[model samples]
Target: MPRNRPLAAVLTTVVLATLTAAVTTAVTTAPVAAGTAGPKTVIANLFEWNWPSVGAECGASLGPRGYGYVQVSPPQEHVRGQEWWVAYQPVSYRIESRKGTRAQFQSMVIACHAAGVKVIVDAVVNHMANTDKSGPGWAGSAWTHYDYPGTYQVQDFHHCGRNGNDDIVNYNDRYEVQNCELANLADLDTGAAYVRDRLAGYLNDLLSLGVDGFRMDASKHMPAADIAALRSRLSRPVYIVQEVIYGAGEPIGPLEYTGNGDVHEFRYGKDLARVFRDERLAYLNNFGEGWGYIPSNVANVFVDNHDTQRDVPGTLTYRDNGIYALANAFMLAWPYGSPTVMSSYEFTDRNQGPPSDSAGRTNNSTCYSGGWRCEHRWPVIANMVGFRNAVAGTGVVNWYDNGWQHIAFGRGSAGYISINDEDFAVTGRSYRTNMPAGRYCDVIHGEKSGSGCTGPVVTVDSGGWFRADIAAHDAVAIHAGARIS
Candidate 1:
């Protein structure tokens, strides 16, 4: 059900005429370090990527580009199928699936750690596969609806009698939402001690394999207290980000899960898309909590994750083209929650799986070909990872906007970026910052080459100002880490 849940929150678009206005604000906090020795929270979600491909990416692109963590899809054995949703249908806790075998999974983790990147596995512990029929799992484990051999049986599941079936219908009912089956899948009785121990045993098995964290799949169906209880059973303290999607008036909201760990701020992406599509860019000045989101510190934000890209309309995805890159740029440059850059495969069919062989083993992604659209490797998005790390703890300063589709801001003296979404090109503009006078490579369009830049190089004078022209729906970013010596 993780792949099929519907969004309960309704986002409204506000249209208004462009206005002219200027705003400035300055805030400072203790600097946080990123890179090898410090905390690097930026995540690259390589959805549906096979183990080998994920490991290769860590060495070739993710590590060198400064991405600290790579969030991979679930690794457990799942129901035999080619659809991506099949990955969410847990047949067993064994680390075997279309992705790879247990040994391959361990090797991938080792490779990632070697490249200074941690691995975060997607954990689907809410329920098992839909029990419409009985079948053999990908790893040859036989399962039928609510039963799996050597695993849980009928007594371990919740059989809430409702809607002529156990399927969840009324989301407003807390008991039904938590206890009833979702999408005909067998729901686990998480509150039961035996079931909790079984789930924790599965997670501890993963911890033994060197996983750094987990993205708890379908956390909404499992109560926040249940998840906290599950965490207490972990072998060691690992980073946990729960997928408690926010619904407008739902009794079970994201705030209830903060004590557990970081919760996905579903509002950030939907509201961001609304502003970019129908509203003005100036509205982003007071983004984050000011816009009614969770506390920034524990808020995990993304433009469009795997679920949102397909299910939640209006949220920016890889399909938005240049606008998508600009949105990612804005997300990385601005001081907000820890952001995740989505890497997706091109698909016309929503349920279609990634490129795979006849036996359903995922093929290696060549990027920009063979149906793999590696957005994480795009020049603008990849280089911006470095920008985010460089400006980690700085606060927004010298904020400037044209009150419509143009805006610029500085991350203290660490970095600065100007984005223009207007139809016409914005030219002959000088942006002032507190960064020391130096030559910096516009990371959005180029890279640092030797003592110079491979593309446009902007020079800041003694006054900490640089003049540049930005094309429609484009961005220019410069940071201290990419300064040309």
Candidate 2:
């Protein structure tokens, strides 16, 4: 499922339209597990981008654009492979993975921190490399099955021998899922105190480096009790977003993990895709618990991720630009789960590594290439980051829908957005924009370019209504950040 396509243009736009293209964005710090009480900003999963690219852009690009954090690839030693998932199978906590070396990683963190972009790394604590032969890892750490040179021994691993070889078979049984190896990856005995100490040491090593949070990978595979215990061992309250996919008949649910931190709402992307694609806009009035995606505070939402982009159906990817952009607008505008923007490369093969050199290091010539696709750079998506931040604590008031495809809503009195999902244009009609009598920049399509608007200019009267025409598959979003009129 790797998409091999030329990278599109670097997405560009400004909310106020005052800054140049390479402007330094003054990033606003936000909390994780976003809700109405969520982070003031959002996260960008820089899938497989190297430390140099990450460090370089922190000040020049991301911070200026108002991103709260960047969830980077696993920055630990692992099996050397061109496939993406190999990073998840760690060899050591050496800070020398495919992304960068130890010094480069530290420098990147310092740079991002200086830019006000918190770094949340993907922490893989569930297992080790799924290898048959013993060899040195990317960081030159040697290890055999459950036996590293100076670390874990054979006793450190679990012996949940399902299918007679420790490979997980019965996912319905919670024990096999947690204790047994996943896809031949060696399962760690997380219940052991010694193992917990070792895990904490690695995590503390990262914490010492000023990492603000962690995205716990395959969190469901580890028992909730163990995760809580692991959190207890942490030195501080680092933001945690557990990766737990709640699918059919899964016994260990996200509710069990919420006591510690947020859980990624895997269903959000799939659900929204279906809702908007079928023109089921009116049914979303009760979008949070009414649609069963509730307990808003602990939910981390996204349109798609590195995993779902290739495999899961009904996810809005880069391929479907119009509908995908609409879904992203709704995600940012909606006040439910805390949203994380997905930034990935263009690929037809799902497992293809990022654009890199022969040694598998990132080729960071352009911010994106035929190999890299930075979705967060898109004007609509990037500006929405500012919009969400602008309307952070506000409630979704002035909800409007045609009882069919078209819809509009106000985030308190701070921001307003309208979507015309119908095939035909809605012309010569007045819509309740819920704004004061003034001129505002429609940031969905463009930005303010000085005293002028690059997108469209909407004139609102005293009654909070505007006579406007909206096209098919397009939306209009305006917030306090870009309001000139």
Instruction: Give the best candidate by lDDT.
Output: 1
Across 257-369, the per-residue lDDT of candidate 1 in tens digits comes to 99999999989889888777667898899899998898998999999998888854578887666667778889998888999999998888788898999999999877767
Tell me each candidate's TM-score.
Answer: 0.92, 0.90
lDDT of each: 0.83, 0.78
Looking at candidate 2, the ten consecutive residues that score lowest on lDDT are 7-16
Residues 1-485 of candidate 2 have per-residue lDDT tens digits of 12122211211121213112211232232212112222455898888888988887776657767788888989989887778887888888899987888888889999999877899999999888887434688878987778876778889999885698998888789988999998888889999999999999999999998889999999999999898999999999999999998867778788888998999988888878778765467777878767776488899999999888886466888666666767888898998888888878777787787877898776662544556657777667777787898788888887888877788898877789888766556788776755677887887766665676776888778898877787655678887666776
Question: How many clashes show up per model?
Answer: 0, 18
In model 1, the runs with Cα more than 4 Å from the true position are 1-38
Best candidate per TM-score, number?
Answer: 1
